[model samples]
Target: MPRTQDFDTAEVVGRARDLFWDKGFEATSIPDLERVTGLNRSSLYNAFTSKRGLFDAAVHDYLDRVVRPRLRILTDEPTRPDAAVRYYRSLAGALASLPDETPGRGCLLLNSAAGFAAHDDTQRSVVDAYQRELSGALTHALRAHDPDASTATLAHRTRLLTSLSVSALLLSRVNRDEAVAVANTAVEQLEEWRRT
Candidate 1:
């Protein structure tokens, strides 16, 4: 008979997600995951197939637990676009506050995209899909608030704002003030779009 898995997969994935988020895909090693997940090398290999598999699982979990939930706050309450803006602003503020000693870790998906987009087809596809989903959520939220807005215009603006958010997260490492300023500008532009 096949051996039953001995650990909670979700718990393991959660730990892996944190490690990957902290160190990123390229920097994180199998030994690091094994240490973080409290799983032996053989068990991790048997369960996840490879480090990339575990990283993929961690990326999925992070999206489901962290990214999607944040997007949901906007999508679920589409009538309140300001809430979406405020939510994004708060994200920027939080990221800007992280200490310098911490490797300036950014969004795992975005970082993965920046570092691996050219070489890895899987990473590129995942990043593209994430952008599409976020843009769709923002577009849906914007339209819900202004039923008369043109679809093309709303889509363009949503893509622009989402790009700004991702850029803010990456840039916060170098210049917190500039990142916050960019976020503020995006918020202002969003506000102006609402009034139009």
Candidate 2:
């Protein structure tokens, strides 16, 4: 039988995820991973196959740990009509709470969209799938908010809200105020729908 591993895979992924979140993939190096995950290069290669593999694992960890929790409010049973709004507010709080050092870290996948996703087919697909997932969750929440909205109207609103959310996440790593504004715009759009 093969030898049993020593470290906790989830813990290792989480540590590597934070390092990648702070520094983009290209910027993060083998030594960096070793430093963050406490796994030397050979061990890292053995466990993850390659740096890209580790990054992929980190990305999935981010989705399960960070993004999904936020999206759960939108997709969970008995979703509140104001869930989309609450999500944006919660997102704003998350952005505000980021330490000064990495205030512009934003969403990790969104960062990939700007960096690797733009040029790498695999990365692009990952970002695209993430967008679709987010859209679906937001659509579910929007439906709860306006049960009578026409299908076309709901579709349009979902697209707009999704765009705003993507913009907010991408901007979070650069300008916190603007990121909050973009996220709030989604909330404002929903409020407008409620009024009219």
Candidate 3:
């Protein structure tokens, strides 16, 4: 008979997600996962298939736990004129909350894209999907705010907000103030558009 999963897979994945979020995919060794998760190498492999498999699971966890919640600010309140601003501020707050010791611990998807995603098709696809989701949310917000906006205008704003959001996230890790500033500027620009 096959052995049942005696441990809580969610709990294991949560711990693994934190470690991967902190250390990136390539830098996190099996021993590191073992140490953090208290699972033996055999157990880890049996449970997740491989380190990359575990990392993929952790990336999905990050998306569900960290990324989706924030992205909701865009989708949930697409009609809100300040939805984009609120979204950016929330991101800034999350960035600010990170410990001072770990600067540049940016978005897991973005960081993974820069590192593991380049060489790993699975990682790259996950990152690409997240990016597409974000872009769609932005497009939704633009259309909500201005239902009659010209297609060209809507497309322009969507691209602009999507780019700004990615840039803000990357910058947040290195410099919180700069990231916040970028967000604030984008907010102001959006607000000005509303006023005019």
Against the true structure, whose lDDT is highest?
2
Give the candidate number with the greatest TM-score.
2
What does candidate 2's lDDT look like per residue over 44-155, in tens digits? 9889999999999999999999989889999989888888889888988877776666667778888888787789999899889999999999999999999999999999
Error of 3 at 122 (Å): 2.2
Which segments of model 1 are wrong by more than 4 Å? Answer: none
> Model 1: per-residue lDDT, tens digit, 1-196?
9889989999999999999887778888888988999999989989999998898899999899988987885677425746657667777677768776654566878888778666999889999998888888777777765678787777777778888888887887567767778778887887777777
Instruction: Compose the digit string of candidate 3's lDDT tens values, residues 1-196.
Output: 9998899999999999999987888999999999999999999999999998898899888889988888888899426856776776777677667666767667888988778789888778988899899988877777766778898998888888878878877886688778777777777777877776
Candidate 2, residue 127: lDDT: 86
State each model's CA lDDT, in order. 0.81, 0.89, 0.83
Q: Predictions ranked by lDDT, top down?
A: 2, 3, 1
Greater TM-score among 1 and 2 belongs to 2
Better of 2 and 3 by lDDT: 2
Residue pairs with colliding backbones in model 1 are: none
Q: Which runs in model 2 stand beyond 4 Å of their true positions?
A: none
Question: Poorest 10 consecutive residues of model 2 by lDDT?
Answer: 95-104
